[model samples]
Target: MASDQSTNPPIMEAKTRHPLHQIADTPTHKLLLKQWLKEEELILSRVSHKESQIDSVRREITQLYIFFFLFHSISLLLLFHASSSSSPSSASASSACKRSWIPSLCALLSSLGIIWAVRYKSEVESHLEKLLEREKEDAKLLRKCVEELKKKGIEFDLLKEVDALRRAKSLRVESKPVRKWSARDFVTLFFFSVSCLVLAMIRLILCD
Candidate 1:
């Protein structure tokens, strides 16, 4: 019974030390752990970088929206001012319109400028909104990938995941080209100019 008790102690000690010995003795486990730590660091860095990019994109979108609002306000004010000045009622206004073609021509140009500005603002707003949506989607995908990597015993290859993320990042949407003046624009401008000239002539004739 004494010998059995002594032998049992050694066996229990060996059993307790076995796992530690195995871990210390193996180079492969240490190497794998080092590699895994490196990968984790790299992934964390990438996620941080993506987060910064998303923040920058968000700021840009906000600026664009502000600018759009400003432009819209300016266009409305210009339109209101043009409408008020172009009225043929007041004798002074008619005399001003007749004295030189300048005031009437200025009103016509201002109206046309407002129309062009409004159209440009609308196009720019739409483009910025689309860009914001894409940035949000990218941020979501990156967060999801990070969560998956943090899971216990997850066997996903980190390199492959990072490569996939890079590929996705590369597939960016191209910006739409800015609209150029078309035949429609020319025609509209021509009509506006002619109408202003005719109105000025009519006012002058009435005043005389």
Candidate 2:
């Protein structure tokens, strides 16, 4: 009777942990830690490449936007001048109106070009920002893994993979061009711009 009484100490059963928790608590931690380090390194490389691309795109957009903005502004000024020059007192009001319409149409065309440029600029900026965000997330994940690795007393070599990945990334960056443009495309754009200006001038003279 004493065995079943308060004199006997109760046996406690051990609590069971989930498999995922078990893995985190064991050798799997080392593997996961290594993966995070590698992931961070890969992300760093990818982000660097993306940043270079963004920079190149930004330069192009900035230069084009300035040209587009000035073109539209000039078109507007020409339209205003043409309109103001037309007077009700003058019998040539009809001719003035015709000339004004030509510049006004050119102004509309230039404005549309500006709108397209802005849209493309916004898209490039958005893409660049996404790359930056992904890089930040990778960094956060790497930090988490490093803290876990430190707790487990893992070797420093596990972290060296990041440096290797970064070095590889640097190699790729070095190989990339600051700008890439074809001679044919440049010639085409130049000719097209000149044609547009010439056409605009022709219209102004003919309509007048």
Candidate 3:
């Protein structure tokens, strides 16, 4: 039963999105289309900006972790080598060398910072998803309105402009996939924090 549950996790229900009303038969169809097109433009703009933010935050966090990992790995090696070559008399001093607290404190702070950033990343992603879903819902209504306008032999200038804007080189969504955070991501972060803290403690152990 447990294995089945794990293999077939229940799918989450889609959240309700704010809907755009279709009023294609009305005399004010043009006005409604114009308002909706403007709203669609705003949604796309925000999605683009938020996606960029998520990318930036991810890169900066990855680079910071790499920096700390290298610094501590080298420190551990040098400290170990120094302890091996030192005489018994200086053992006490060498052991005292292990009491270094700066790197450990910094590691703790970095771990905290990364955790916080990961949370921020999650929030941004959730917001982006909501925007995309809302856009999809609105698209359905917009298309219905367009079809009605077309059948009536009415041409909408705003609709044409919006379609052009959507096809614009700058505004269009790229082909690249948006990366999702997974269990592996969380594990990697946990391991990084633990490994750094352990190494710093090893330096302290060397002193004793």
**Model 2 alpha-carbon miss at residue 129, Å:** 0.5
In the range 1-208, model 2's lDDT, one tens digit per residue, is: 9777644443211124343444455575557665767877887888888888888887876787678657755654665575557554555665664565565566556655655665666577766877677576667656755665564343334446456545544554323357666443464465457546645654554344
Highest-scoring model, TM-score: 3
The reply for model 3, stretches above 4 Å from the true place, is 1-27, 81-94, 97-110, 113-185, 200-208
Query: How do the residues 70-171 of candidate 3 rate in per-residue lDDT, one tens digit apiece?
Result: 756676677667666767577576555655565556556666665566556555655665665555545555555545544443334556655654555245
Clashing pairs in 2: none
Tell me the lDDT of model 2 at 9.
48
| lDDT score, candidate 3 | 0.58
Q: Could you give me the TM-score of model 1 versus the true structure?
A: 0.40
lDDT of 1 by residue, 33-106 (tens): 45545655665566566556656655664564455446444644554455456766687666654554554455
Rank all candidate structures by their lDDT, best first, as comma-separated numbers.
2, 3, 1
Cα shift from native, residue 144, model 3 (Å)? 4.7
